[model samples]
Target: MPAKTKTSFHKPATWSDVAPLLVDVAMGRQKADLVVRNGRWVNVHSGEIIPATDIAIAGGRFAYCGPDASHAIGEGTRVVDAAGRYLVPGLCDAHMHVESGMVTVTEFCRAVIPHGTTSMFIDPHEIANVLGLEGVRLMHDEATAQPVNVYVQMPSCVPSAPGLENAGAALGPKEVNEAMAWDNIIGLGEVMNFPGVAANDATMRGEIAATVAAGRTVGGHYASPDLGLPFHGYVAGGPEDDHEGTRAEDAIARVRQGMKAMLRLGSAWYDVASQVKAVTEQGLDPRNFILCTDDSHSGTLVKDGHMDRVVRHAIAQGLNPITAIQMATLNTAQHFRLERELGSIAPGRLADFLIVSDLAALTIDEVYGRGVRLARNGQLEIDIPAWSYPASARNTVKLGHRLAAKDFDIAAPKGTREARARVIGVIENQAPTRALEADLPVAKGIVGMDRRNDVCQIALVERHRGTGAVVNGFVSGFGYTQDCAMASTVAHDSHHMIVVGTNKQDMAAAANRLGQVGGGVIMFSKGKELALVEMPIAGLMSDERAEIVAEKAEKLTRAMRDMGCSLNNAYMQHSLLALVVIPELRISDVGIVDVTQFAKVDLFV
Candidate 1:
């Protein structure tokens, strides 16, 4: 009897099977799955520019890449004419969050695939804070089903900063260990509790130990600007990489201490240029650094590019084009320890690459994933099946009762004409805010917003537990000239409801509007609802398609601008007001957070 013949598609491909399959294709025993002829390959590993190469793929992995691949091709093999285009490795986001895009995992994937992003290491901590273990599972399950590589990092900090803010759900060391066992989980998410780690808090250390014991990476988030003992202590606590660095020194410190400095260029966080100077001008090793977009809104992802935009920005910041590409592709993959599988265009790596006409402009004309064409000409060519989130993942907003104007009223000191109040000042294009103090007038026994001073009232309404607990503080960033308010349930780290407005009535209307729509961003001006962007999933992610969501987000941004808020991506800035982790001031259901002091301070002084 003749021996049985092995065939492609007999089973799911693994690393062990790739070699044999490549050998079969190279020897002409089995046909190549796909072939790309005549392309200049961007060799990130060797830092060389090799031109006119043919690449053969077998079982979704690169079989051979050389001057010619005619022998590997058979009658049934698919061929892609590169037309002398540059075959760069698929872009990888080193650190990011799917929830930050205000879309579900599937939608976010759909939006970025055309931008040449193939691999993403996402931290679902935003949902983890809202729905806990269950929310994480939803993001994880959906991420695994996507066509692109979406690896989950178990959220290390649910509330982000312990004792600072209260989250709907909490994740402990046990939860961290359990998530590490997940099939797609790569490592621990950003350890935002820098204070906890620096102070040798048992919980933070236990979480780090659990991830390290599982042989996975521990992500970092040292948001503080202190590069002194506190920074060193946090580094000693075992975080493998950090994305919170804002200056060149921050990057130098992290890389010098054997940690990957992940410089981010999100819509609001312009941190890459300052940090990339560490390598470009200071002549540091570029391999130890990575580029990422920690928080990009859907509007930014749709209008601007994803990793491609980050790479271009790095290039504009004086990084060589190849070096910038390496930062986005190879450096990112190495930091996540996924280099062998998904970073480069090597023989054993997955056949994920981009065909670009212009390297400097990054004009991506085609994107191939696992040797199959996924997108072309800035549009997805393949179908990404819709993922329907369960009812448990929807309608998470639980305000309990309708909010009233009185809920946002700030009571002044008895019989006082004016009083000094602490204000959470929003900074444009940055995460940290100024903890400013303002002496404001009192009217009808209530403190009033000073529109002339840009001081608007900010409130954090409890949504997770339906506790009707509203923490009020003053903010002076959105220059509201009219009686308008903007409210959203997509507050970072805590995922509570944040309402900022010049008028108490408008603030109440905006907060109640989100409750009515399950959860989303709502803007009200002069007793009329101006715009609403619904995000029913965990009050954090929208179930809509990317284009629709982007349109709504644009309208929302326009509405904010119409209401006199001039900050770029003001909604993103607004949503982060409740992020008690970053300094210098923030709001939580507990009270106003003095992040610089790491304590809750009185709203009135």
Candidate 2:
């Protein structure tokens, strides 16, 4: 009898093939493809640090890991001496947005590979909002082309919030079911509509049901602090894991409710330290908790690190080194139902691991993906090709006509000299905002920004439809002391045009500047452009190299700081001004959204 035909040489072998290969390699009947010699394995399954372990690889899978692989290694087999280093499993990002890095998928992989990130579960909802299902397919296809493992999560909410906001594109239950059949799509992306879930909205439930029916995990984003009936209802709606918790109790509650607790440490979000206490102080099961970076910008990925930085932060927050590594590795894999294929250095798993010189320092000397060295000494050793999207992704910033100062003017009430206005107060390093009220003097029949009180005007331009609609409101957290404006087309969920400035002239200039350059971020101060980061791809991400994007992002940050804006990671705060899905106050194309009420409210009372 002849053997069966296989799809690919590197594909996971059937039990019969893997079982035979294991026994043959152990008995020296078959030569191993590669052998990693003399290393201390950080065994996540048993929580033991086993020294003098050898890992043998064949067909891109681990065939044997024991005291020695000398018999398995023949003249044709390659050998890599670990030199008594720590063999840690390749890091995995459980939840992340590739667009937040402001680079293409290939560029993001290139940037994080050196940091020992071997697997990523990406939510391309940003692009989904821009180009609909076609955008998601583009991301999924590009993810498949990468050398490292990059899985896609079908976007659960394209517009994010129905009725409350309108995105460039919309997705529903049909799209969810269609995406589930794709080879690269592992599950559904973050279901951001907590209100709908709590109210048993049909659309939200339908999407969740489709994901569940497909036997895939449902990502969650319950941004509200009310972990009461609403949280319980969302959990019951079938979201398997959530990363929006910012408190210790939030982590404890999620784990208690049989949902995985994902603690994120992004470039701006400082959430891990507060939530990780559930395990360190409250004595919760660490197995139910995972570490992730929900959104990381190019500057952080280039200058700092990726999952390695998150693991180090977890360790510094009073977690044991092995435990922290497990949160970023095995814990994430288990939640995604990919434990057998990844997240550990055991037999029958993909041969992906990192060689670290110091466990305490986490200094990665080499990174391996599928038994191949991808990075060495903090730089990528492998060449990853760049990918390009269709022309539809470019020139996304459609302002209808060039914006002017008059478009931002807020007309005062007929005879009103003074008015109290609802202002969106940005909370530094968090997603939620405070609904603040401020008294302002009406001048020349127009309501103006109170610069003396650090108040600035915010406007949302409908860029997708070219409606030329500018919804005006006030925001009081950037602390800008100059007559400057910051404009971006990367507004969250909706991806509309957001302009914030003290003076309307600079606002117009900044808005028009992005319009002229296709789409990107621009900072204009005193009528002169201070910084511009061109994101021609969907007006959200740049197609340039990661390092180039990081340089431009650094300039944008410095320019914001130079103009007296002092909130930490103010760029993240700036981009999220139009995110109506989160809480308290936000601006949209329709009107100023009082998210606490989940309805549009008057800017002035």
Candidate 3:
């Protein structure tokens, strides 16, 4: 009734209520709050750059956007001279996990604001796995309070793959319906349970029904490469947007099925190059393609850029500058059904825009959100209030006991000198891993890593429920040459502890060190600590500023390199080693999972 009584920093007033104020400002009956004059407006709606444009804003919404806005300018108005720079809509990230940046939502906003990302559609499922609905609520509140528009998508799949792994929390139809009523919720998050949806599972379908009934978009994750019946069946289940496509064919299929194809580029996921070809090579309408950074590392956010990086990559893939900007801006807004609210420089829309000095290289000179200058020349112009997570959200790294070096021992079958084991093969800059078979040596009843074969031991230590259970497996492709171990509590979907090491004692020390510090990633080498990034919030995000986290992340990557590991952003690959939903192979608290089969398999095959 009456639009469900929602109010937040993201949606402070309905356009109907603001229309009168806009009319007064545009007609010079009232002074505008802010004005940007003498610019070239990049009209996403018309697909043209009109020179000598002016825009007037009042009440955080654009009131006049035309050749001139001098009529609304008054002594109180804050006037910004664009000096003929291109006025572009503030970039939008259509799909992302804020926690993937390893920082809280406030810090994420602070980090990306200077790079021209004014809106983000974030999925809090990573937190939901650790703290359940309480965690989602915490992130939802924090996101709505930010200066930029951060819309929450109620996490659809918590455990991600039911019956495959253990998660700290679970969400069903009840949680979905409850979150739908939240003031800042934009839609349901990526339905990671693709198999369940394809199989017509009632619970999964019912979550989609609830979001549709609430009139919100449903995010999709068809991680499989198959475009046959299962893919069609999943689309029939009602997810209207997907960011999991890693190929041009994947993008074509998703768009053909009436879903917006989101090409993502993040710390490790280099998908935009392959999938944007759906538009650049296949001649599909570019409007159906959206750009996103599904999982940006903190270092990438600070050193590189956020959505700005994605747009640049898309342009490099041979898209016109306006077309590339549309993929990151207007197309994203249309996909989320928020076109009139943001994503374009037009009257009655939020005054979220960027001043750009170059169209092709896309250099952002200033960033604005809600008619307020947020950043200029790649620096924050205002203070973003710090947000604090409650104590319950902290201290989430629960190890049932102080893990001992002996606990990491993978004892081979008695009397076996060597063991033929299944190993997860890590491919550089990809989410999926390869299932390979390797022969490893065993000594004194324990299986040892084969550094000669580039194989190491991987363990999934149960953090949720703290059962003290450890699932052991072998993994390759890290190329470690010394006594080094790395452990992380930010395991995907389930948030378990993933430990990969060349030796047991170092692995044990890495795991125990995380237990001592609440939660985060730690690397140990030769009985010494190498790198640590403290993620105290639900074992997924740090409460500090993103710059600080970025610095820590840089040091962490350097440590990985020093350990002789040669993968691009190997920490991202390490964190996702336990994501049972992605295909080929993965490890979980139960055992190693053959994701293509979605079934648990033994280590020694």
The candidate maximizing lDDT is: 3
Q: How accurate is candidate 2 locally (lDDT)?
A: 0.90
Tens-digit lDDT string for candidate 2 (1-605): 23322222233444456778767886889999899999999999999999999999887778888999999999989999999999999999999999999999999999999999999999999999988999999999999888788999999887888888899999999999999999889999998998898899998899999989988989988888888998899999889899999899898888999999999999889899999999999999899999999999999999999999999999999999999999999998988889988999998888889999999779999999888888888878766766888898888888999888999999987899987899999999998888999988899999978988988999998999888889999999999998899999999989998999998999999999898888889999989999999999999999899999999999999999998999888999998988888888999988999888899999998
TM-score (C-alpha, index-matched) for candidate 2: 0.97
Query: Between prediction 2 and prediction 3, which has the larger TM-score?
Result: 3
Error of 2 at 584 (Å): 1.3
Residue 589 in model 1: lDDT: 86
Model 2 worst lDDT window (10 residues): 1-10
Please identify which of the two predictions, 1 or 3, would achieve the higher lDDT against the true structure.
3
Query: Cα lDDT for residue 225, model 1?
Result: 88
Model 2, residue pairs in steric clash: none
Q: Once superposed on the true structure, which residue ranges of model 1 sit more than 4 Å away at CA?
A: 1-12
lDDT of 1: 0.90
Off by over 4 Å in 2: 1-23
Candidate 3's C-alpha runs over 4 A off are 1-11
TM-score (C-alpha, index-matched) for candidate 3: 0.97
Please list the C-alpha lDDT of all candidates, in the order they appear. Answer: 0.90, 0.90, 0.92
